[model samples]
Target: MGLGVERFTTQLPEHLHCFVCLDVSYPPVIVCALEHQMCESCATELRKSSSKGKCPMCAQTMLDPVRTSGVLKRAIEDYEVTCRYTGCKWVGCLLDEPTHAKSCDFREIPCALCKTPYQHSRSVQHMLVCPEEVVLCPQGGKRCARKKRCELEKHLSDFCGQWQCRVVQGCDTRTSLANLPAHEKTCADAAARIAKLEEALSGRNETLATILTELRAKLDSLDPTRHASPPRFDWPAGQPAERTVSTCTLVKQLLTRATKRRHRRATLAATALLAKPLPSPHVAVLQESAPASPPAPALA
Candidate 1:
């Protein structure tokens, strides 16, 4: 009548069905002495009932419960089964039953936090207020209200109202995400002032460098070794007067020799003048009167 009954009837072959349970063997099929196949649950029940662990079908004493052959194992895995949960119509391989059970909408599972049973599809919604779940704090948990772990990063970065400015220096202002832009503008002004101060300091360094260069040049000019000549001896002012007197005597001797040479030249000039005879006025008059007697003397 139900889907599960119909699926079991159609999908599971009669040969693979457990002899005791009369259903398809899920896994761990047990083999008795007569090779009669049964589910492990039925085999375990039979062993407990009889003191000697006798097989129900053969009446033989069961020593060790052997597993079903490979052919039976494969056949059991390939058989299709309908979901056991009420109102679920899912039908697939027996091997895939566990996977379908985990996600089945009608199946109930215990919540990780509240420990209350919730349908698998509604488990996520119920976890929001589960008492056992631990969460993080908003505002990066640095100093803000606690929040769910899943929503912490988003709340801190996008929605927290108590977030502080990240500027570590020159400003210790605290502001919310809504006023962060205004605080950043203030920080920008402070940064600009610092840059101006640094530029002025650099200019002052350049001026100091120029002044140092000028001073170095002046010092080099004042160094005496740059214009030095050969050394000469200088007499002291307190030396003996005898050296000065000897210098004056040598000068007077040179002047006396010069005066004697001049007198000798004047004396030679006077002697040459006195050696010539002088013509008297009376002799000049007699030569003029005897001029006519000269012609008669030349004829004799």
Candidate 2:
């Protein structure tokens, strides 16, 4: 009763309790010269009842005014206290017990919004479903209006659908900004998807490079004497130095091969270019292509 705890008596040891009232001796524990300890209320009442300052325990003439026991007060303050709230599982010192009680999640507190008292631990559940509660969109920024928590999902889809991600370099982060604990899956994880696409394109690039190297080598072998003389094409009447049919055939073959590979290359390029994340409706992705290496000085 002294501490105003619901189950205060259940945790205190018998030795710490007042001898008269059998309650935990809180601060201001009055002590007689013989060191008999009782609550301040009990000491005051006993003094009023007796003609002389009489010891309650031994029936002896006691000191005129019993002094407050500083030693006992300090000792009791260090005592371990278990929270009085059932199922709270908060164990702390007697000094911190009062403070913890005020902020304990198990304790019922009035909501600032609805003004209805509910257990603070279940605040998320209550806030989401409480008819009186109103919440703002988390991703909608300043544009979205406050809506009932129950109807927030529809509002997010309809109202916050156009909310663009302001992620630095867009897809550079390792995790999605929207993917938080108990948060809705709103935006795509751009980083992870881009990583996968880069992986797939990596092997394809090596293959394309090998093909280019082989073609270049073949072209170099065909024009073995390219350095000696500049090969001349079939010109109008009185043109000098006639070129071979083999050179023309080689050029045709190379063009045919390039045309065939161009479609394949374009298909792969298109696939990479259209990297659409499943969750995102509109994408503002950008990529810079490296300048194409000058085709190995073509020999005509």
Candidate 3:
């Protein structure tokens, strides 16, 4: 009395498959005048294969393919498809299949140069600095290998034996690449000479500093009135003669004091020089080489 009817089905419609490729049609699906749909990629291949550009199913003349309708596009998107890649069991909506394929770890991609298979996304980056890829040494072929591109620079800088010293002014010593630091530390002759020169310079500096201090002190003592301004006198006209005479006497006293201070300074300097023992033979030679003072000119 009753025939069983299956209510629900998740199967994709046959019209949604490309007629030429016999695979699920992806957007933008091309439609013939009879409304027969084909995937865009298959439609292009079919056109290229056929000089007359005929539709595979209807044998009708093919024209430029138009964009698929939104309702059909949505229906295709809702349909689920299993991953085409072998060993991958992922199942998702038709719209997201391409994205999943792009990021899928199990997808195989061939290397650009070596043609070795690798994971899909990492293939391009692996090619860039690949160890198997040959590259020349950066140091103009100084006993360096045409090693891997990633290791070429490191080989020249850190492992090449022909590298020269980096020190600019001193020590032209050239050594092996790894021995540069060790050679710089024990570079004997130049280092010893530099040390001796530095010691001599320090001694000269000390002697100069002592002489400068003595000279400064002597100058200070000699010119007591150096910073003192001359006395300003506002003498009114018709002043007493005795007041004028007193002013002149005061000025004479100041000049006499300045002259005495100068003589005293010269005496003290000479005495100090005589009292100091010469610390080095160089000082005795300097004293002997100094010029004699000329006799004072006769007063006219």
Which 10 residues in a row give candidate 2 its minimum summed lDDT? 173-182
Put down candidate 3 lDDT per residue, 1-300, tens digits, no spaces: 110111112556776656666555666465467666777776677677745567767777776654565666777777666765666778876678789888787688877666777767566677776667887665446456678776776777777665555554555566666787777666655677888999999999999999999999999889998868899775444556645558676677668878999999999999999999868899889999999999999999
Clashes of 1: 0
Candidate 1: clashing pairs of residues: none
lDDT of 1 by residue, 173-243 (tens): 76667788888788888888988999999999999999999998898899988668878644333545635
What does candidate 2 score on TM? 0.31
- Residue by residue across 175-276, what tens digits does model 2's lDDT show? 223333112233345455777899999989999999999998999889968656776643434433445435676667668778989999999998987885
Best-to-worst order by lDDT is: 1, 3, 2
| RMSD in order of candidates | 30.8, 31.3, 23.6
Q: CA lDDT of each candidate?
A: 0.69, 0.67, 0.69
Question: What lDDT is reached at residue 86 by model 1?
Answer: 69
Off by over 4 Å in 3: 1-108, 114-128, 135-146, 150-159, 162-174, 178-182, 188-196, 230-300
Task: Show model 2 residue runs off by greater than 4 Å.
Answer: 2-14, 31-34, 40-55, 58-67, 111-117, 124-300
TM-score of 1: 0.36
Error of 2 at 276 (Å): 87
Error at 147, model 1, angstroms: 19
- As a whole number from 0 to 100, the lDDT of residue 24 in candidate 1 is 59
